[model samples]
Target: MTQTNRVSICHVAVGDLWAGAEVQLKVLLSKLVLRPDLNLSVILFNGGRLSEEIERLGIPVSVFPEDEWGSGKMLFELVRKFQRSDMKIIHTHKYKDTILAAPAAKLCGIPYVVRTVHGLREPFEGLEAFKMSLYESIERTVHRLCVNSIIGVSSQIERRYMAEGAVPRVVCIRNGIDLEKKPIQADRWLTRKELGVDAETCLIGTIGRLTPVKGLSYLLQAVPILLRQRANVRLLIVGDGVIRKDLEAQARDLGIGENVVFLGHREDTLELMQALDIFVLPSLSEGIPMALLEAMAASRAVVASRVGGIPEIVDDGVEGILVEPMDVTRLAESCLRLIDSPETAMKMGEQARKKVVQEFSATAMADRVAGLYKELVTSR
Candidate 1:
């Protein structure tokens, strides 16, 4: 395709939070922009880490800060942007973005409007629960009226949407990360020293927002059990969220505060992954978690929950050990097993890294998405 004939596509999302969807979006666009037949741009509701990263990639990014403008004003501006740019495809992520941009894209006569279902919604209660329900309802209506395609990050997610009949077309495209940039290992020992952990200490780590859906409270409950068997073990809790204080309190209440360290949100996650002997993800739900993929990429043996897209990525005794989400006893047992059998853990970690390189590299994911864009353009 010639440069003038290249398809113009714009991605819209709420990019304030650097969570799973945001991370996936960043990787997708970073790789997608290299395609010769595609011209890409981004429109984010908030400008922070996500916008900065996309900008660093040399892509055109327009921020419509949620705080600066109301929804009506933003929609008007987005429609004008679409019309002026001659954008052929409008891809959106998150409920608010889809509800706002999908209809506007349809109004502009855009050839395709696509949205990715990153994962199942996190649980809420009381007034927040009601608000979430209302949002989902409006999102569904928008999908029916405007969206041409929906992308699910896992097969299970695709099946759920197919079953619910939320949209006319749905496709399963698993999430992936860049395999070329391996986790930094030169400072592995230095990082452990900085964390006050020695080589002999079995450093267990989990990375994610400290939210209820992460099932971190269960990880903490499992910690007391892990302590009963081993005294040299330490748990590293990375990332911060709404429930940070609650989780910290739970650790103290269980009398395992000294064994757990809350590192909060750190920019050096890849470096930190190399310092750990084992990686654990005890989430109540997930959708091809990027952290799990990164830990596996780092060649760290993992103990993760059997939920959402997790089982699709990990075999019970192969890449990592899988346990029931709330099974505190089993979670602790899995961790202890890996700690006691170093050779077995090392073998599993090696296999995990190989799996990512073979099946889940960011190049593979971007190719799939680009293929879809072409197919949709052809149909249009």
Candidate 2:
């Protein structure tokens, strides 16, 4: 379709928070709002901290109280909203949003209904997994039956969905970052000193919610090993969630609590990225973590698990080191390798930054998304 014939797009996101998906949504919406050729509106299942941020940036957002857990009055309300709007394309992000929005989009007779799968749902250690599996199965079925397009953040994610038989014209669109706006540089001494680290300390940092899926416990297990070999090593964890207290206790139990600093949630993530010597992501599963990209863009060496879309971004011995997920010993070894070889780490960081600048700029991502919308709407 020509730009003039494109339809207004309504994006349905799970919520407003500082997670990877939320940050991507905010960046994409901010870019789309400035384009006169596209009409966009974002619907959040619930609103929180990011609500004001989105509004402040002049993007239209509506909050619906329907929790993504089950079918209820909330689902009806969403359907009614779609029916009343002139939305030509309804794109859902995350599982719950896709499940709930698929039916509504079909009922409203919208020509294009797309779902972007960010991560694969997995079984939890306890009863939650049973419920999660059931819901995920239903969601997969809905995607198979209703959604027009299924977009994956990485080829790994696309393969996972295909394996589950939820294939629906899958497309790989890696997440992008804004490289023009450089990360804020903190006075390295001041930031580390505030965290009780000295000038000679080598700071290893990870930016993500303190959740089990992040495999933070595994990262903590590697800390004692790293510290025993290098006393100057310190860990700086940024972000908070339901698992904060558990992670804190785990760090203490490992006898390395004093060497670890929990910065909680912060608005100055880029500045935090600047203060770090190395970035680590030990997630057991992920879909192209934006934090890793942002850290690499800041020219920081990364030590991330070899899972999901991480390998797509960081080549195993090139831009960063990729260790097996949950291998505390290997994880620690990778961090140590980076620390011992500062010059090599710096070289990798430089290469990682160049890769991000060349391939993952936010403007490039937005243009591709807009182009996809044009293709879908024009075909109809």
Candidate 3:
């Protein structure tokens, strides 16, 4: 598409923080804003951290206040906003955003309405699960009726939704990172001192929101086992969420409180990744975790659950070790193995770094997305 003919994209998001979807949105917008062919605008459900960041990128942000309308009125407001802005494309992230904005896109006569699925629906059990399933069914119907295309961060997520007959026009686009960004400098000694970690300790760290799906409880279970064998081992958790207090209590109850540090949400995650001996992600589910990619990019040997798009990235006994989700014994064993065999771990880290550089660069991902946008706009 030429500069004048390029579509105007209105990216809508409901969240207020830079989580996985938010990070991906930021990366896409930052790149798109610099493209002369495209005009970009961002719409947030409520303005906070993310809106501020979006504005900093020189993209105009429109915020919808919580009390501006009744529960059902927001959709009409969004539709009016899109119409007034004359957006050519409406790209949304998160289920709530897609659900609310899809009809808006249609009503505004937007040519393309794209929704990116960040992860599969969380497994639900019992009455709550039944209710969730019903809601998901309705959302699926809305997606089919209103959205032009669906993008999944992983093939697994795409297949899952496809099996449900929810998304017929689904595509997989693995999340990417900037490999040319400054590498995480190895400052193990200084980081240990600053975090009060013992210089001689073997540290196992995990980074993600403190949510049940993250399966941080499983990591907590593994800590006692590792401490039983190697008393000098420590666990460092980064990121904060609803379950932070609960996880802290779990560590205390498990009697590994002293060895576990809940460093809630650090901006210097890359630097912290460098100071760790091993990076672990024990999530019950995931969709190509950006943290794991950053770990691999930082050359940290990883021990992650063998679920979601993890296997696609970490080859067992090669790039990194993958254990079954919530398998505390195996998770601990993987950590111990890496700690005991420094040579193998270093080799694995090197391989992981090379894999990320060659396969998951930000430029490659952006180019693919740009191509898709062009294809869609031109086809119209």
For each candidate, the alpha-carbon lDDT, in order, equals 0.92, 0.85, 0.85
lDDT for each residue of candidate 1 in 279-345, tens digit (9 for 90 to 100): 9999988999999999999999999999999999998999989999899999999999999999999
The TM-scores, one per candidate, come to 0.97, 0.94, 0.95
Which 10-residue window of candidate 1 scores lowest in summed lDDT? 177-186
Clash pairs, candidate 3, are: none
Across 1-380, the per-residue lDDT of candidate 3 in tens digits comes to: 67567668888898566788788777767777777788888888877778888899999998886456654788888977877875778889887788889888887788888888888777668998999888887788788888877888888987876676655467878888877566656577888789888767888998888989999999999999998888999899999999999999999999999999999988888889988889999999889889999999989999999999898889999999999998899999999999889999999999999999998877777777777788777884
Better of 1 and 3 by lDDT: 1
List clashing residue pairs in candidate 2.
none
- On lDDT, the leading prediction is 1
* Model 3 spans with C-alpha error above 4 angstroms: 1-3, 166-168, 184-186
Q: After best superposition, candidate 2 residue 132: deviation in angstroms?
A: 2.4
Model 2, CA-based lDDT: 0.85
TM accuracy, model 2: 0.94
For residue 184, model 1's alpha carbon misses the true position, in angstroms, by 2.1
Give the runs in model 1 whose Cα sits over 4 Å from its true position.
Answer: none
By TM-score, how accurate is candidate 3? Answer: 0.95
Give candidate 2 regions above 4 Å deviation: 1-6, 67-70, 163-167
Residue-level lDDT for 214 in candidate 2? 96
